[model samples]
Target: MTIVDTALHDSLRVLKLSGMLHTLDARLVQAQAGELGHLEFLQVLCHDEITRRETMSMQRRLRRARFEQTTTLEEFDFHASPKLPAAQIR
Candidate 1:
């Protein structure tokens, strides 16, 4: 990374913009390749940060819920419990 890039990254880190920091390099590459305008580049960075934060929030919530395993109704073995009404589950 260049000196300017390093300085910018440090500033972002100090400001606690970790999501942006993580995606900065990739976004820069995309901007260069696509010739994105300044506003468009900023938009991409902000969008990535928002998405990263939302995904992190969901993972944290899931961890707090302490699920033994993830499963869907389709994966359930209805044959094992024929007496149970499968239609009600839907």
Candidate 2:
């Protein structure tokens, strides 16, 4: 495994690369073992960052909406509302 210097670690944090930082050690190990190609390692890091941002964005939007409760169509009890158009909603 490669050792990440304090300077580089701080740089990554300053640059807001939390997702990549989180998995850097494991990825480094894979790279050292020749399990991951250079491009693939970068791709994985980018994917992690993208997924993290998307999830955070969604949560922020939901909090801003101030909904009393969040529920999906699948969570709705069809049996509780037999008169409602559950099939059509689905």
Candidate 3:
């Protein structure tokens, strides 16, 4: 009975070691993946200002087109088409 108990304990120890090694490897891989993803996020941030500026410029053009001399209702068809939005009513 004592021998059987000792064998069972040894098997459990081996299993524990295997599980720990697997978990450690997984953690290291995850850390590497996280670092790569962080780099991508930084690249996105670097271009964000440019993206914002272009968007604002486009918006300004749209705003200008909206308020640029349209006294007639047919000419001022804002929100009715993708080409024009936020135009004056009549």
Alpha-carbon TM-score of each model against the true structure:
0.72, 0.73, 0.30
lDDT of 2 at 56: 91
lDDT of 2 by residue, 1-90 (tens): 225556666877999989878887788789879988999988988888888889999999999999999988999898998999998999
Q: Tell me how many clashing residue pairs each candidate has.
A: 0, 0, 0
RMSD vs true structure, all candidates = 4.2, 3.4, 20.5
| Superior candidate under TM-score, 2 versus 3 | 2
Q: Give candidate 1's whole-model lDDT.
A: 0.90
Model 2: how far residue 84 lies from native, Å: 11
Cα error, candidate 2, residue 47 (Å): 0.7
Off by over 4 Å in 2: 1-4, 77-90
| Residue 44 shift from truth in candidate 1, angstroms | 0.4
RMSD of 1: 4.2
Model 1 bad stretches (over 4 Å): 72-90
Q: Which pairs of residues collide in model 1?
A: none
Can you give the lDDT of residue 86 in candidate 1? 96
* Candidate 3 runs further than 4 Å off: 1-39, 67-90
